[model samples]
Target: MDIRFLVTFMEVAQTRHFGKAAENLYLTQSAVSARIKQLEEYFNAALFVRNRNSLQLTAAGEKLLPFASSLADTLEQARATMNEESIQYLSIASTSNAWDMYLKHKLDEVKGHLDHVSIRAEICSHEQLSRMVHEHSIDLALTTLPFKSDDVEILELSDSMLSLYCSVGIIEEALEHFNISIDWGQKTNEALEKIYPEIKKASMRTGSLQVALNYLSTHNSAIILPAQIAKELVNAGKLHEVDSLSPLTVKCYLIYLKQSKDARLKKFIEVFKGMIENQQGR
Candidate 1:
């Protein structure tokens, strides 16, 4: 069977429209139709049933779709594995601050293990990271909070705390520090809800911790951030911890699909586990 035909069939099956599939594949609509027809001829099965304005996969098509997708995915994974690139390509998803803080450090330790591994970082919510991992779009994920899942293994890397901070210059001059608040995440928001109910309305809201830091740096206000992030700025005299909520301890977790036996992944987990262990021992 032609892989190209299978590819075309899968595309059309997904979109359920020849024109849309062709657009996705960068081919002409007529060409896509021809390919689908050829595939049907080869398979001797009607893959799609078309009404006046709707498309539905026939029983044969329904059965074939999963196999075709798995084959394509296997091919892609095979390429990813056998490529002689210096760095093994690794896709990672995490919140911005976690990426900024630990990923670089971990990458430095793991670089020697691969010829070269390309690192792709996406700053997303924990749930989004889990979804991406499940879709096989990401190889691993780093998160500062725990997620509920049995399929994904959560490796605890470090115990951390969140604190409020800002540039030293800004903090020094601010009078009504009462207007300060955090960029409210479910974890931090709930923490704040319980710990400091007085600070209900956020002075600013940001999607990422980095943005909250930037906002705090530029304005005479306060932002609650991970203690590790706050630690750096505070040590540099660029920020200080607000007394209202001094610290909030949380675990930083490295999450990945529980497929325990990929060599590359195993090597990475070993390296990172050692690195973190050594860091803690010191």
Candidate 2:
């Protein structure tokens, strides 16, 4: 039996839909179906059954699940180990907001501290981060929210303050910066909605900070930004703090495989945390 057949069977089993499995595997649906048919023939057992438009595994498939999963994981681990031994490489990734809020600033510092290892930094979706970390495709992942996975350990990194800013200060000197929440995670979004009900009515909202800043550079709307960055822009006379709405507290999180103890990843985490502390002290 071909390993590709097992791989296709696993994908189909996981998704329970040939079309979805094909899309994820980047193969034609007919190809995926053919592979599954070949796999069933090789096993001399029907692996799946269709009922009420829903796909389900037969007893044979249920028994094969553990073996298939173990084989695929072992093969992937072997490939990753070979690549790591050949290149001495480490990969880190994050959602765009988390990348900007945490890892982006300290990446160069991490590179310097881990100069002997090659680093690949990436911006990816939360799902991609979770999947890559679990599959050993990425060494570390930073996120605005933690992933609930038995395969990975979740680590709380730091809480970053995001403030509201505009092009000009309001006439209210009595206003002071206060703590609020923006849409970094489920909790934050709920908090934001609870506190500032009007935020829901705002005509413009965005996930990318760069887009907000570019819009604020010429427009009159407010943008939520990291407090440190907002301060620097304010000092440069490019933006002003909008102190009425209060700042947002976004907690950073990290995810990595539970079995991983890579020294390069360990060193990068330590250096990055120290940098955050130093920046806070300043």
The candidate that wins on lDDT is 2
Give the number of the best model, judged by TM-score.
Answer: 1
RMSD of each: 9.3, 9.0
In order, how many clashes per candidate?
A: 8, 0
lDDT of 1: 0.70
lDDT per residue for candidate 1 within 173-261, as digits (tens), equals 44345345644457767877676565566676555666666666667665566666677777887777765354666556788767445
The clash number for model 2 is: 0
lDDT of each: 0.70, 0.71
Candidate 2 structure lDDT: 0.71
Window of ten residues with lowest summed lDDT in model 1: 175-184
Off-target runs (Cα >4 Å) in candidate 1 are 1-87, 113-116, 166-175, 178-180, 183-188, 244-247
Candidate 2: stretches off by over 4 Å = 1-87, 169-182, 244-248, 261-282
Error of 1 at 94 (Å): 1.9
